[model samples]
Target: MRSRPELHGTNGAVSSTHWLASAAGAAAFDRGGNAFDAAATAAFVIQVVEPHLNGPAGDTPIMVYDAAAEEVKVVCGQGPMPSAATVGAFRERGLAEVPASGLLPACVPGAFGAWLRVVGRYGRLPIADVLAPAIRYAEDGYPLLPNASRMISALAPLFRDEWTESGATYLNGGRAPKPGARVRNPILARTFQRILDEAKARTSNREAQAEAAIDIFYEGFVAEAIDDFMATAKPLDSTGSRNAGLLTGADMAAWRPVVEDPVVVGYRGLLVHKPGPWSQGPVFLQQLALLEGFDLKEFGFGSADHLHTVVECAKLAFADREAWYGDPNHADVPIAALLDPEYSAARRALISGAPSSILRPGSPGGRVPWVPSFAPSSTATDGPDWLAELGEGIPAIMRLTASTGDTTCISATDREGNMVVATPSGGWLKSSPVVPGLGFPLGTRGQMALLAEGHNNVLAPGKRPRTTLSPTLVCTDDGRPYLAFGTPGGDQQDQWTLNFFLNHVDFGMSPQQAIEAATFHSEHVPTSFSPRQSFPLGVSVEDGIPETAIAELRRRGHQVRVTPAMSLGKVCATGARSDGGVFAAASPRGEQAYGVAR
Candidate 1:
């Protein structure tokens, strides 16, 4: 049974990982804004409410379906490495890989710029109007989430002892705030207010105001603050040592988010749109390609055969992601050949009843696949992760980052068939020290890059890291915008969201039912974050799954572990219903995600 009612409306619908964020989107819709405006509003609110999962200095890959243009485009807000970020630098530090935390792995923050572009290009609202709710939440205070409080409490010592600015921002008078307690970040509020003031003072045009806000953030005050912080702050990193960040004010000024065509693939009369090889987005399309050959409906939903087949297929696709996906501007990713029917068909032939113990990346188009040979998995970060006690993070759900933080998701749609899904992640309080006076941390996204030469994702200046932030857009076979959906949980994002999508498509379940249904995923591929790790044969099953199915999976040589019911993903979705209504759904897992429509 669904924990909440299905959200349906002909006017507008929005879904996000946090209730307040979703409410903000609903408010935006009420303010006579379009889906793009509502989504941008919610994305900023998510940065404030889900601070542990994302920050202003983080990254988000936005998938947008514009009704007027009748086109689907991806505004990639993922920042590239600083000009100084090179493999030789890590080698000089005597490190084989990038550290999980601290300034050394910092990248030009792309989220703020991305949202600015949204407000300028697609949204009807001004930048100040779109940012109002988040500024209010930060200034007047919003209730602290249980998970956020737990993360703060766990890192209290590290914050107080070392990351003083973070302590000042997160801790209440040197004490961790209890969960659900009202919390405020005046510094962040002031920073945002300053940007607004500067923008309004300089421009009267809405789009020009958005551009001015971008200048305040990237080429102006925000970048200066980040530069001052990174220049002197050598905080503890995953290497268990202090290191300064390579990101500079110039790097911040040099980067801008891009709006480009999406990587498209067809599956069962639906056209799935994902970001390019710079992210793990294509991994989802690849999985669909492989599964297209299987008659999942014939095996029945949630059946033993169904679970085994999907899990095995996930392993094959994700392996390809690790080997091939990277910044297209800097790397020669054979994405076209990888997603081709013949290539996927050949890869699908490898999956059998017995699980494969090896991480197998296919050679697409006869090009040799390069899988990095790394040591066993390690979570050697600067801080203690309460993840085991909290039952979250990489080992449990597939680690998306090397640090203790995960990610967040937001999706929005309206009566006009406009849709948007933004997966914002990185720059966690646990990953890097907050910049003084800014109340946010620079993202450590560069850690996802390999230091080894010859690999496409190897550490390089101006290259975007191959992030696991994958948001999805689905369209009808004829190209009408259908759904915008995504989730958190790092490497598990695609896995869990795919399960939810399949639940709706193959099982004939409603959006809410699909979200409420038990979810599962495989961690059989190498992790994308720092301290890259892999579990070659492990398949996590939610408790609600059938006992017979679990037994069958185990008997098939799958290392199946029964996780807490609904512990897997925090997926949110907004879609156009056949009845011409906008429908939305959110995962009730952890009581975090929410959906609203009217």
Candidate 2:
């Protein structure tokens, strides 16, 4: 039984990690906008209300099914490393790993440009309509979330002592404000207003306005602020030392959001689409390819046999991620060979009745595999309980103090068969110091890069990091738009969504049921975050899972970490129904997540 009923509508549907953001999307639909416009609008609003989880300077990978083009496109909103960001530069600094939350690992901010581009290219409404909600929330005020408050409170000492700009933007007289207090960022509001003013001055056309807006952010005042801030700001990071960032105004002007085709795999008649190798998305497809061999429905939903098979497959797929997945523009990722049926079959042979402790990424196409190992991450005993829940977006682990990273999700669908889903993350309040005047932080995605030279994901000038911000889009057997869904868990994104997809397709569960159902994931492979912690033979499960399965998992040598019920995932989904209607559903795990349709 689902805790909340799935919302159905003949007009449009919206589901997001936050209720306010979903409501903002619904408002966009009421304004005669399509799914892309609704989604972009919601994302901007998300940047305002969920500041602890995401900021405007973060990354956003969007999956859009445009009814006009009759094609699905993946928007690469992840920014590349700065021109000065090189392995040699990092090594010269005497750093083995990129600092977690500082300017040193900074990259160009990508969310504004990506959102504007998606809406400008396929949306019906004007750019101003898409940005108004976010601007209003920033200018006026919105109720602070408990999570955001906790993040601020936990980092209060750091903010007061070092990240004073962050303290100015988020704190009340150098102290973290209470949850539910009215929070305002007039500077952020003014920043967008300036962009809007400049864009309107340049163009009267809606589409041109979008392009003009993008230019303003990347090449105009916003970029100038970022450059100025990074030019002199020395702030504390995961290294426990203050460092300047590498990102410059030139890097901002040089980078642009690219629209590309998504990597896809067929699963039980549905075409499952995920972002390219630049993201950890194809790992989800790899899992799908392997699971196609198993009769999961016959294994029964949430059964010990089912969970074991999924976890084992996750280990194999993620092992490949750690060894191979990277920006294809910089390196050759054997994605095609990795997804081949023969390769999947050969890898499937590795799964047994018992949990496997070995990390195994298959040698696809006779290529050698190499996985990096790292020291354990530092955790503060006094940190908030939500630390692990914060998806490992921007990584930098601190042993002596505290550091964290997180992200959020947005999804929308309309009656016209337009669908869009995006995972906007990075630049969390705890990720980096707030850029002065911009009221946000530069993303530390470069931290995901490895110090190991010649590695697929090694730090390099102008190369995109292998991001975990992946969103999934699905199509019917006939190639028509079906569904869009994603969550805000770093390494767990593919694992959690893979389980949810199986719950929907294989076990015949409804969308709401699939999201609310018990979830499990294996952290057996090395994490993408700093310190690169790995848990060999480990599987984390919701307490909602059958105790029998837990005991069985232990019996099979699986070290299970049982978490509180309804605490694993925060997935949101919007999909098309066969009867020409649309549906939306949000995970009950995040009380703020909501689904609305009209």
Candidate 3:
């Protein structure tokens, strides 16, 4: 549990899920690369070593702070659903949701697209140089770190279908590899080599190399292979098999990452930049607003009062998420209204005198600024008697399973004062093959929706799923960048980030203390899945909080349960002081996470 060596230079630092990736990126910064170069390098390396979480086949959402321009830019590396992918298409085929396999799961891979966009816009080094570390790791092999080995072993049993490529990768050799085992992804190596060669041939024009590499995946050999594989895949339900018909060669070839205006909200003196309603970023702001009126210090740290206030705020925010949040192109998300101080004040006024046995359903309040041209589908369903009974008895499923797992995050800063924070992932491995050589599975993120008619997140043509992934940046009142950080853990990410921010900003805790502090999550938060949804709302904090606090919560009518330590979240952070020195910290909860500053 000892901390790794702190990398410090007068210049910069990089922090991410794995130490190897962080070091590689820090080296890039030391080699005269900008923050974009460092971040792009780290991103490629993360795909190689942390394949279970992210890879070339995943999506990436990025925020770049350019010191020169003195402006922040956001890139939505999220791939879009194929134009042909419609709710009617799923129903006509008698499917409840988009099957994990074949075309339905396919989307334009956006990670590489985002990397290229950032480097082209902000980097000084060539793409080949930025990607060299990942190329070498993929070819030469790296040790299986503790966290990676644990995740692979834990998830191996779930890969029961022997025909899938993902099953072959994890379940092959008769058993999952243990930590410290040497693992090589030559296929991934070859892909990186190709990218490197293409970049070199482009005469160091990083953007050209990126475009060519993207072509190789979407319009070249990769596209042909995916299409061919889908043609012979198994049927999703009793009717017909899914295929790459929707994600034709043309879709991938035409796909490009988009740069959108970030939805910024001022908190105190700092500005929090979050992606649009396509993600749960606004939820964080809403939670922060709800807590503004409360004296958190009065609860004394991890007391019952602290946990109750946090959980109640989370529930209210989540309720609004269900009722109002969605892709702005398809639904009207009340962004401005949700962040209004007055609106938060009204919501805060609803807390009852006594701790309730169940969460109080919240209202969206006032009118949304932008309304959708067409009404979106709903996910509700008329269940059988047994299912109805289960829903009432166990609301935790709504709380726990609201989002799918599988994502990676990176935080980087360079000597010139540039910074970038990004999260790239979608859990397609649960549904598709680990394209041989790609080292990971394409995201079936579209499956986060329900097959039930009229669901808010139903798989509609050209619609994006509501993602739990959020990459964040904070700036000081004087407009200097202060922190860049993010995490991977689905719904737990927001809760963890909120905790860390409160620790650092409110309690004046250092990076290590903020990340290392014990934390609790609201079992009341809604999840993307069914069954346990909202059932655990009244559950109280067991561990983390002091024992006295637990007893007090019990006296206040909470149903508390004790459990072992969990991966509360895997968060990585890099902070800069007015003196220009950088401090980086990674969550000790993850065996792979580390920080490198130079």
lDDT (0 to 1) per candidate: 0.85, 0.85, 0.67
lDDT by residue (61-120, candidate 3, tens digit) is 898888997777788887777677777877666555555333465666778777877887
In order, how many clashes per candidate?
Answer: 2, 2, 31
Instruction: State how far residue 384 of model 1 sits from its true place (Å).
Output: 7.2
TM-score of 3: 0.86
TM-score of each predicted structure versus truth: 0.96, 0.96, 0.86
Off by over 4 Å in 3: 1-9, 99-103, 146-161, 167-174, 235-246, 353-405, 427-429, 436-439, 450-456, 529-532, 536-542
lDDT of 2 by residue, 302-386 (tens): 8999999999888889889989989999998999999999999999999899888888877999999987665344322243332
Candidate 1, residue 252: CA error in Å? 1.0
Question: Across residues 175-247, which tens digit of lDDT does each residue of candidate 1 receive?
Answer: 7899899999989999999999999999899999998998889999999999998888888655666778899
Backbone clash total for model 2 is: 2
RMSD of 2: 3.0
- Write down the worst ten-residue block by lDDT for model 2: 396-405
